[model samples]
Target: MSDNEWPRQLPAPDHGEWHDPPQARGRVLLAAGLVITVLLVAGGVAWQLMSNGSSQPVTQPSAAPVASATQPSVTPCPDPELTVAVAPEMEPVISQAAATLKPAGQRCSAIQVRAEEPGVTVDAEDQPDVWVPSSSAWLRIAADRKHVYQTSGATLGWSPIVLASPAALTAQYAKDGKTAWAGLIQAVTEDRVPVITMPDPLITTTGLLSVHGVHAATALTTKDPGIAQLRALTLRSRLTEAAADPSALIAQMSRQTDAVTASFQVGVFPVVEQQVTIYQKGGYRIPLIASVPVDGQIEADYPFAVRKGVKAGLAEQLRDAISKSAVTAAGFRTQPTAGGARLPDSAAEMLAPVKQWAQFQSLAFQVLLLIDNSGSMNEKIGAGTATKASLLRESGASAAELFNEQTTIGMWYFGAGSVSDPAHTEVVSIGPIAADVGGKSRREALAEKIGAYGPQASAGTPLYQSVLDGIAVMRPKVQAGRPAVVVVLTDGTDGGTRFAMSHQDFLKRLGAAQDPARPVPVIAVGYGPDANMNALQDMAKATGGQAIAARNPADLASAMAKAFLAARSAT
Candidate 1:
């Protein structure tokens, strides 16, 4: 029979219903038929007994010699443990679920999950036995639909991203009748509210959701000015660093003197529950209240999936647990409960959140442009009136525009002091440009600061000293994982510094400050007749950057733009 064929059930013969043959010659045939009927009856009875054994409370059957000889022993499988991998944002719910599962004698293990920024791609290629993404975007990016699909992953779980404020401030706003979501968004976007904190939208689901919620309420989807205003507010924010967990953000809020507003998950109940105690213990006198936005709502759904290539039994157990009641009580909706194969709830929730909070996707850059302010810079290099000052200004302007509001531009003027006089050597800090639009443009500001830099053709250049000063000033502000860049433009050799730190020293310091596994690139540009091309190349090579020789001011602009593109691409 083919494998698809169903097994046939045999019928038993009735007791005392045997028929005899008419003739003595047919007696042998009748006897043979009687024996065969008896055997079939016994076999049918045995099959029924075996089939009904587990459900019926009964004694074991007595072993018949022939049946016992034919029967084989069956070995049972050992109980399997259920494992789950969850995103870091949903740890509270996952932990609670794990606790409940443990007491029921159902073995459970949880893996911490973190989604890659901008896209919810898994940072690591290896799949967990069960993967739970904080956002649906993560599920789409991380999982292969054809191989292992989302059987069921969606639920109405609250991951509230509140606009946190001091209780006093919230009360004041409430009294003024201006505490709605619309009011808050307007106030924040218009700069009426000075101090506000938000997570990097690229990194945090809550941040992204909050932005989307606001956008939807305002109907400002196509408005460029509105978009730019929101972008500016997000960019000017001093805090974008993600805490290890939600609790850490709460701790930061509890310690603040100013009324700080930020987004956080509602499931982190401990943050709300312990607010008074934290405040009292910390001797904080201010009242902090958490309020949900009136016009918009956020419901984040986290899904647990078995990673590809996981062992079969463990994967099945995990799927079963995810589909079971225990997980639902902890706030996860199982596949069967979600009604479809796709994680729809999670997907819907992700859309609005990401759109509003897309500004966090902007790259973080550190650019140090070292300009050559020697006497030769006064001479024009191109048809567009490109002097050294003009070249430096042009390069700085291009960098500022290319980087736009994303990069921090710092300017340094070298060879300003007497080249021969070591004591007169000076390295002026012109502009450390941040996202502030009101601050002087990095290039124009630097030109104004070093307008008097010329005519003194000094005997030496304090090249190494200027590099050290630039590094020293910029190091403290450097954030980990951000691209740190130093762009040097010089037209002379190393000459004036009393203390000579070799190129190796510079490399060692720069490398030590950065993660050795992912070092920063430092580009160098040369201009003028006396420009030390070899030294610039050495500096760039040492830092994994490039050295470009731009003979004219226009060339300098192209070079800077190229460098800016490279920096953005790195992100």
Candidate 2:
């Protein structure tokens, strides 16, 4: 339900002061200082990753990234050593416990503590023996993408994802009542709250929470018109240091604009509950108020999960050491221990589509679809097999059958031609898939065009020239945050004599024209057994994309979809 659907907003929870009790304050200051120091260092490193590596492709870990991992990246010390990957805020508590875990007669059992971002641990080649993320969403997303140990880690403590905005901004939109995602989105749509920011989804679990909550409270499903409104709002952001903590964004927002003025509505940030606590304790350059949705709740339930093959008794020993409930800190809220529970795979799969929706809101996907009209595409399989072109026609035609009205599509079919005169033809110009007035839907038109598509006028395969043509068309569509890609469906390599540029010139052109900041991943897909995988792979890697091979023509649809999502969102 929306904000207006409910009469009143729930009272904001009253939080405690940000300091330790008088009795313990004096004794633990040094330890608290070290932990806080580690947090600061971690923040700096994250900022660097954002500024420097934002353009790099997302590389999967080489190891069995998912199944049968031994332990996280650390070896056992001669003495008993347990390496624990803890969220930055929980480092001190876990580290303290590590100091005391000695085998009955042993001198010490070292807990090598590493302060990692929410989703980083899952990527460790040697999976961290224990995975503790701020929110279960991280663990869940990691599992959906790969086969992780798939266990629900223990919840050590809780941190809700809150909206940190100036009192004036909340009053403008949410005053006289409570604000929920519905209200927040309404305000944004009409331009009441113009400046809103979120951290990078890859680096902060809070980012995922904000994404999920916004998705849940508003659309609940990507199919809702509400998603379009969210997409419009996402396109208006101006904050930087997207991979860093709330501190970096808060500091930056302060300098950009403070409380509401004639020109500014206070910036609304989706931040961790602890960051709000830190600000309320009074070190922030700006003052802020925290708000959680009345109907929708989002929290980081720091889960301590164990990997497979952990010695029979080690998982329990680690779980006990991390989430004893007796162990609490000022910034964190102590919660009851949640034993070994796992998010069901079926549920994770159901929720996974919303993530792609969220990514699309901030990341625009501009893709050019290239279909081969070569004679080979017309070849039928053994006796009963349909031609590759026939399969493409069937899949492309089914788009109109789905409830989803996707972004505009540009469809082209290529064959033989030179640099001066390209061998390709545009079946559908690059434009919105739906027309403003009466016209057969682009989806329907596309399906018809491809279904009837036959071999090119000649039997030549102008694969090289067509690739260059595709790059030219997709390059201009690249934008920051929104990724662009060129997807090609082909049955064979270049056999035509229309190749204009030397293989070197084509390489040099793509290399020099490529923009790391707004990379256009050209995903080359080889359909059927005769297609050249090596040629396709080289083109894909050169443009920061991938080449996928499928032995059967019928599987091209699924393969193309996979390549589309990965190429556009991988970086």
Candidate 3:
């Protein structure tokens, strides 16, 4: 019905009441009453509408909206509280990220960040809801220990492992181009840059990765140069603890004018790239430079691991809130491809070097150096100008430099007389190298003895008898924590005149002398091609020692280093 048109007044109810019987008359009266009521109501509405139109047009009010229980509200749910455990180096960046998550503004989570070492976190009984470790290796370590966590499957930031050194020492090398691990190894080995400190592999992931890098670079070689390098460092006390702060080293390097002295005083260390960035900002006298290994960069890919029970929404929110800009601004590369080298996927493969380093550290040295002064020693080695005896003297002095004050060493040269008649002459009895002997250090006296020794041109080799007599004499002197070793350097087969035991008899006796509780390994060096290597090998195997075949001066020197390392670390 149109609003403007008033309802046509109902046809005037027949106002004339019918003149009929009493019942009919009563119904007619009721009908008339209903008509009169309708007319009165319509007339009243018309009167009100006319009065409102005359004054002003009427406006109707909208119906009130129903309060809904299921509709979404304008305000958001309360922000959740999240606990984050991060690596020590990542603490600052992660803390900055946490502050950006304001509960009152963007409705982000309330993050509680704590700086923790990944090694400690791996074994922790109670873990945080979120964990950001410096390297993904820690995740493998955690999994190996059955510490369950769900990785975000993305790295938050990246920093490659680098060889950190003073810019002054490495200026020429760095200017040449990016240095490889081989170059670093060669430099350290040649004493171009003397001291090289490595963090203890057992204590820090940086140390673990550094050793792994060295191992990977030398994987194809028969014996890693790292072993020899490590042995040298151990003897020289150059391998320092994981006290990585380089302030003292920088100060010492800055003052030294001589390159050799500076090399000895200052050492290069392996650390993450971010540490170099932080160190450079310190404004030290000697600025440190980081050389990324070109063969493969062992990087610290900061993994964002989420615990099982943490809400997925909260975890994702946190991951997104930590922006790429923030990460880069904090000196972290946002991409996983930042490193050139890829680490081993398996946890055990990555941990192999760490185990080897631990073995190297467990050595306590007590060694006997038995040299052959037989006629064969005067023969030239492999067309070289140096004779076997001359090379032996040189290598012996170098090896002697490897022993610290704690090592007990003795020297003996044998080739004359019979086995029962004291054929071998002792140059120095087994004693501490630092001990005073004849008003001079035993080390000095020993050096002098090795330098002056000459070959006995008429003497027989007597190889079997010398080993037997050395073992018999040294076995009783074995101390509890020290490994007692008899290192025999021979160049020919035994020329026995029915006085020395046969090779087979020697092997049997060596095996019979074995004491599982107290082992004394016989590390024998078979020098030159004609040496009795088979005999030496058999005897060495019988006593859990090694037989090294040395063809020339270089081979003898290298092999001797390995033999000494094996002897020191035996058992």
Most lDDT-accurate candidate: 3
lDDT of candidate 2 over 230-346, digit per residue (tens) = 332232222322344665554444443223331132356777676567455544433567766653466777777665555536556656665454334436677632321223255
Which digits, one per residue and each the tens of the lDDT, describe model 3 over residues 1-571? 1121111111222224334686864454345334433433342223223322534468999899998999788776463478888876677667766666655666555677777777678768877888998887877877888776788957888887887765445632343758656666545333344346776565566776777776556443325353344433332232433444333344344444333233334546777786666555444433466878775468778888988777867667777777778677656778765535567787787776576555554345788888988777888866768788887777666566566545788989878744453557788987887677898778778878888879877677767777877887778877787768899988888774344677778777777777777777899898888888899888888878888888654567677766766776654
When sorted by lDDT, best at the front, the candidate numbers are: 3, 2, 1
lDDT of each: 0.46, 0.59, 0.66
Q: Tell me how many clashing residue pairs each candidate has.
A: 10, 5, 1
TM, every model: 0.38, 0.46, 0.57
lDDT over C-alpha atoms for residue 280 of model 1 = 34
- Tens-place lDDT digits, model 1, residues 265-369: 111111211222333334442334555455544434555555555655644433344434544443333432221112234544544335333433345676676
Decide which is better by TM-score, 1 or 3.
Answer: 3
Show model 2 residue runs off by greater than 4 Å.
1-80, 102-109, 140-154, 220-244, 250-266, 283-285, 312-318, 321-328, 335-351, 354-571
Candidate 3 lDDT trough over 10 residues, lowest sum: 1-10
Q: Ten consecutive residues with minimal summed lDDT in candidate 2?
A: 1-10
Which stretches in model 1 have alpha-carbon errors above 4 Å? 1-80, 88-128, 140-237, 240-244, 251-301, 304-368, 371-486, 489-522, 525-539, 542-571
Candidate 1, residue 538: lDDT: 72
